[model samples]
Target chain A: MINRRDFMKLSAVGGGAVFLSGLSQITQAAAAYDDFYFVQLSDSHWGYQGPANPEANNTLRKAVETVNGLELQPDFIMFTGDLTHTTDDPKERRKRLTEFRDIVSDLKVKNVHFIPGEHDASLDNGAAFKEFFGETHYSFDHKGVHFVTLDNVSDPGASIGEAQLAWLAADLAKQARDARIVVFTHRPLFDLVPKWDWATRDGAKVVQILMEYPNVTVFYGHIHQENHHMTGHIAHHSAKSLVFPLPAPGSQDKRTPLPWNPAAPFSGLGFREVEAEDKPFQLKITEFPVTRA
Target chain B: MDLQISKGWKIGTACLAILALVSIGAAHSAAPKTGKERVVKVVAKRFIYTPNEIILKAGVPARLEFTSLDFVHGFKVPDLDIRVDLPPGKVTTVHLTPQKAGVYDFLCDNFCGVGHEEMSGKIIVKD
Candidate 1:
């Protein structure tokens, strides 16, 4: 049965929302392109070594290759988090950041924004992540659009908390009502399901802050597989992994973090690119395969 | 399908994949002993599980040699209902025996983030 959320998602994509779908659709702007394009690369579990994601088996190495291959230069790059894996280990954590740094070092692009998923912050509530990366939740402006990168995960109980909400309200308040806004995070701001590590605890507060914005889009990583849902004018999207794919949300009882299938090499690992035109920017998504060189 | 688990794997791993914080608090009452009977070693890294799917019979014990090359990860089988954390650089192992005949899904329960949800495979049990 087609669910309402699925239906909304269908409307977003099939209902004619994605400006361009792939590399083949690249076209020159006729008039002033208010459309600014950006790349969203999620779930790149660097440091994970397995046959499933051998292309990124070295973590740092594959990311460089993937980002370098963007057909067109994006306005910026947003990695929604999961910068590392696990806790209780410093060497591995350092390896994760070091590799991330290595990839960033080789990058010829500018302004790469990041957010922490539950994993990177899981060990010590993202103390390690803060040490390496900057603030967990922050917002910025690009062109005529407002971009909010939130910290919805990294807590023990999956709560968005209070401090971040205060920051969000102040940030969004600074933007014009007609200005376009895009919020990026690792976890969904809406409740997909609380019991299964989906929904955000204080996600509602974040939503309230964005309610004033006419054009709002929420992009999240985590969940692995592709998922999209829209509430009011807010659209939530989850990107595919550069590693493996998981079952739909709430599919099993802690029965996820599924393994990779050699038969399905780079099956679910892909990328999402969005171009915004007319200030807010027109968006596009391309699912490029993981190159295993 | 919805993404909830009553919770479960075959093989494979990820970089920022699964944050496997194994809180196996209260003894693993059934922690299989490292015995000399039947043991199987599994190499988990990247995202693909070697030997894709495995068919095992009941009463047969198998040891998993899981190793995480990139970061840390977890190995879980739903029908079998077992979870083991595979930290980077270490060859971790676990033992299990299939109790029924069916296709079971194994997933990374550690929320390795992003691809963490989809990082999984399957286990087939044959009578």
Candidate 2:
């Protein structure tokens, strides 16, 4: 009963399993493991209180609970941005940021990186966000992969200014041309849709700098939707928001928050989990929606 | 005697009429003049401003009335020093007199969602 096609499929599956097993063994052998995984949670909007999210107060808590309950522990969690909804009062802003930090502290993962969204940075040029999160933009290395977190939100006009670009250039220059690079920011680095303010003013320059690298990937979370784009060989992936979902670019005359359906309370709210292997271009990303337990 | 009384009354009447006319003229002069007023209606939703692009004539005063279709949003033209907070179901008005002829970017200062950064528009002033 096994035809040529069936035999070929079976062989392919068996080979894949063996290859995966060997990869796992290699991953386990490394004491200084190069392969790892991380979670990206963005736009928690911790202090948001409205009908759009009747469960706004509990969303972040639930997200933390969900992360804690995951079967596989993430090496770290990077919150893309919008940790808290903006407030005019500095005291309230600080309080919100503190509350967000305190809540996220419940996550089993100890290493959490944060970047600011326009909400967190636009008010006072990120003075409060910087006070709470420290260094709006910076870079670090993990397991041979270079991770750069840029602060596109801290500037008054959603831009990655000259200084940051210079810093990025200098930082990238030190790495090998073939080094695996992952850039994380809150806003899209390309002109996705200028009318909706989705485009970063100076993102083109940043992309230009990134194009120099042989391997690069960008993960951001301002659009509140799952979107994939590419600039040259670099791939740009946008994650969903932890709070609410936004309309697609230019879908409506105005970009408005999609109403939360009471029936399906957590319809469009979720976080992204990314797994990176030691090999270049071996990143597996999955988006998980928040569901009631 | 009749002639003297009639003449005095006539003079008094004439003086009263003159005073009334002068008061009416003064009131007319003191009244404020109405200038041409332009009103621009803007609806702010989640992440985009309605009528994202606007054109105005320089030296002309304008009233921008902003209303949020949903959520609390903000409208700010940093160059024009215009900032207004728009609560859902409420109308906020911003008065602007553009003296310069150029393009001014107006953005939503309040964070509505992931698309908050993209919620901006342009105000073009023509000479």
Candidate 3:
């Protein structure tokens, strides 16, 4: 399934098995983690199979392994998106979804929340994503925290349409003011570069609504790397991909497909262990590798 | 490998390869010479390509080795038109020859955001 462009990129890298070690334990551990609980995993890319990360399918299972081993069991797990590569075939997307579900079947945690990326939505604008994973953009409450997920990938790249913004407004209307709100999506709100493939067109409106909430935090994935920034009252955090890392931005002249590195795939992939303190609606993320803790 | 067997294909490839090789060699004649086929190491961890910019000699296919320390990263040189998806637990080698001198750019084209754009660097192909 490699196009001329895709194939060239794939063929350029020298091949060999690269066994990498995950980062050693990182836990600011203290009574601070006694409150709420959540885990953020992104860019599973279930259907993506290549030398970039040969174990792309199994890595998700390993992430689940990390989730199961957490000392403080998360109340739920939030997967931002990019559940598959690019394919408009419903059957292929569904198959990938099925595999995603199967990977979690072994997990000890019962509840896992998810959002969509462009890949999973390629088939009928996330029709497969919604059908397989449930509502794309919706909100819910667990104790004192209000968790919201917006559908930024419903459009071309990362975008939250006008109708969806109206819905987000209506959704926020139901939450109490003091409730700590956490929004999830697949792209960053900042203008990473509108020309290539970074910024989300309608993310500004979503940010506008989010600004209304006091202690709001947004979690996103898509730009398969780790990034953290504070947009006024809203703090944006992007999750690392279980698949591969990408250029920062404009690192290259053109935004092209990165080649497949045979030796290593799990190099930059890590999970964020977020513990939410229920009483005050506060959440803290401690980045950790999926390796045995 | 792309140059053989079929008549039309062979003729086309022979011409392109010869064109590329000859042009590349001509460009190499102007070296004040910063360096030659230097070893550049890049580490990918948690979505970041460390020490992104890699200096090299123009008009020569240099060997660049990269590995991911954390997650999967894609090291791509758009001007050179090369892209490599680096995964953890693997070492990847990319051989590229930038014909035209000057500064050619490389980026984390995989959309490793927030600073993904900043995750870019230059392959200072010294003349």
lDDT of 1 by residue, A1-293 (tens): 76323333443442133533211222332232244567787877777665555656544455557667644456788888876654447677777877776677676577788788777786567777887778888888776667888887766445677877787888877765655677899888886754354667568888888877766788888777678787776778888776667777777645355666667666666666666644223445544445533
Q: Which stretches of candidate 2 lie over 4 Å from their true place?
A: A1-33, B1-127
Model 2: per-residue lDDT, tens digit, A1-293?
Answer: 65433333343342221111111212222234355778889998888887779899999999899888766677889999989987767898899999999999899999999999887887678899889889999999887678999998876567689999999999999987767778999999997865556778689999999988767889998889888887877788888888889998768745678999988888888886776665323566666776435
lDDT per residue (tens digit) for residues B67-112 in model 1: 6666566676533435656667655655455545667666554555
Give the distance in Å from residue B93's predicted Cα in candidate 2 to where it truly belongs. Answer: 21
TM-score of every candidate relative to the true structure: 0.61, 0.67, 0.60
Q: Residue A39 lDDT in model 3?
A: 75
Instruction: Find the candidate with the highest lDDT and give its number.
Output: 2
Better of 1 and 3 by lDDT: 3
Cα miss at B38, model 2 (Å)?
A: 13
Model 3 over residues B1-127: C-alpha lDDT tens digits? 3222111111112112111111112223322232655556667764455666667665565656677775455565534435556656756555445555566555554444333434666667675
Worst 10 residues of 3 chain A by lDDT: A15-24
* lDDT score for residue A90 of model 1: 67
Best by TM-score: 2
Residue A91 lDDT in candidate 2: 92
What interface RMSD does every candidate have? 6.7, 6.1, 8.9
**lDDT (10s digit) by residue, model 3, range A26-110:** 1222222235556788888887776667677678889888778754466788888887775546687688888887887787877
